[model samples]
Target: MEIKHNPQLTSTELATLWNTYMADSMGRCILTHFKQTVEDQYIAEIIDTALQIAKNHIDTITELFHEEKIPIPQGFGVNDLNNNAPRLFGDLFYLRYIEHMGRTGLTTYALAKAISSRKDIRELYKLWYNQTEKMFDMAIDLALENGTLVKPPYIDYPKEVQFVENDKFLGHFFGKKRSLLAIEITHLGTNIEVCNVGQTILLGFSQVANSNELRQFFYRGAKIGKKQISTFLGILKDNNTSYPSTWDSLITDSLESPFSDKLMLFQANLLSAIAMADYGTAIGGSVRKDIGVIYARLMAELANYAEDGAKYMIKERWLEKPPQTHDRYKLINRKD
Candidate 1:
């Protein structure tokens, strides 16, 4: 396909295109995984709905690209998948992955809507965002039904500190002497590192993606990471903690090529999940309820994003299949 430069493609337009492409590509990948592992008819229905949304978006964007006479970005296709591979995870873990992905999709769609300028693109985003929101709700319900969602320990009030004085357990030893402010500072630093890592990954992937939409998605994600880093720094300073030095290492600099879409999505989702867990732990350890709440929300958002990415990986056959358990066998001959 001959590529044409459409100067009318504003930054926002480019971003929307990128998000649409990524979402569609990943969604198709996850749907394949769901078809192989999901047992319950109801749960399968929900997964199907999500798949439909992704497919629809892909079609819509393709049409848009055609209308604009712009070349659509090349991404992973059905040929890249191997859905019949041996299961890699249990059914419970698979459900958990889907639940997380739905949440992530919602966040990404919402962010895209906020930044997009063209009415046609914004309208398309609104439609997909609503679809993602529905998918998230359905995933949560399915997770609850299947008992797969992780329930964080509920704490009603602050508890007394108990120091574990063991040199081998570095976390325990360091945690004992650290004030709440100090711990918050450490968490802030970690968050900054995660954001930087994510940005680098996205930037590297963006440079290699053939689709304009894919590149834009990475750029948008990079922008979001920058904002998040700024926010964390502000919180650190407000709490009278020193901000950590900026991350200067470029993981992508040594690489000459772009990552495959499946690989990129997998890495992004995995990183987001790790960050979510870290943020959640920070919230639990923080003394300030307000700060805790903020971190908690951010963690939730990241969790959702990671889950979405995981679903796509599964569909693409990049991830392993979840395991299945059989019912207990009856003792047919023991009665004699």
Candidate 2:
């Protein structure tokens, strides 16, 4: 296990590094603007730490990409941010944003570390995972301290571990459907939480975006997010469970552009992608037919939305070129 081979990067390893770099680049620009406009000193410190972590990862990943001879992605940077623009969101929302991002980071790095092959890449992801985990913890602490943290629903402790007795465990299309399993509740709660965060961000983005097309795209995404939130909340209410807190009121009325249209579109697209992944995971985890079917529909909607967002990005030439396979046909037909 100690042996280190400088072998060609596997597709999975390459993907994990490449994707992280792209997301991290966006995070760097976002947090930079956040750090500039933030008024609360406590929230400022957390933003600074997050910005530092994102910057470090971008630097490290760029080096790795260069060594592997893979083309670096044209991710966001100084040109994508306008820090002098008025604040689009308040301090509380900034902290809440960090909290949502921390949770996503933990999940992302964990998956990346699991799939990485090369020793160096695995080690790198592990380092990022540890750092991201720390950030999650700090965000949680800050959210709790600031009274912004939303805990999942509280259910009574089960009497004992009991197996499913019959077909009723999966529920039905007729009368008297079975109740939700604890695991099902967990996944539902998780999706709702992340969806709310997505909705909140989309709302703010739709408000201050400069380009009309970008504004429309964000508005469309926000509408989808709102519907998704309603679906999740209705499910919880039907099953008699508490819902998580909403930060929709945290947004400001500022119409000034804080981020470039490119940055805004990319962020919207990135979060929608993550939301799609989250729904897929939820479908896999839920055993209930209804839950799975609902998530499948939600995932489909997200896919369509993402496709539109990608086309918009392409039209605007904001889409970054990722590392891809060589064109064998083109090489064979070359005039040279």
lDDT leader: 2
Provide backbone clash counts, one per model: 15, 0
Evaluate model 2: give its lDDT. Answer: 0.83
Per-residue CA lDDT of model 2 for 1-336, tens digit only, reads 576567899888887778888888888988887888899898898898899999999999888779878787888888988878888878877887788888888888888888877778788888888888888788889878878788887789988988878877887765765677777778778777787777778888888988777778888888898898889888888888776755564788889878888888888888888888888888888888888889999999999999998998898788877767899999999998
Q: Please name the candidate that would achieve the greatest TM-score relative to the true structure.
A: 2
For model 2, what is the alpha-carbon lDDT of residue 214? Answer: 76
Clashes of 2: 0
Q: Superposing every Cα of model 1 onto the true structure, what RMSD results?
A: 20.7
- lDDT by residue for model 1 (131-176), tens: 8888878877876776554432222344788665754332232223
Q: What are the TM-scores, per candidate, against the unseen true structure? A: 0.50, 0.95
lDDT measured at residue 325 in model 2 versus the true structure, 0 to 100 = 82
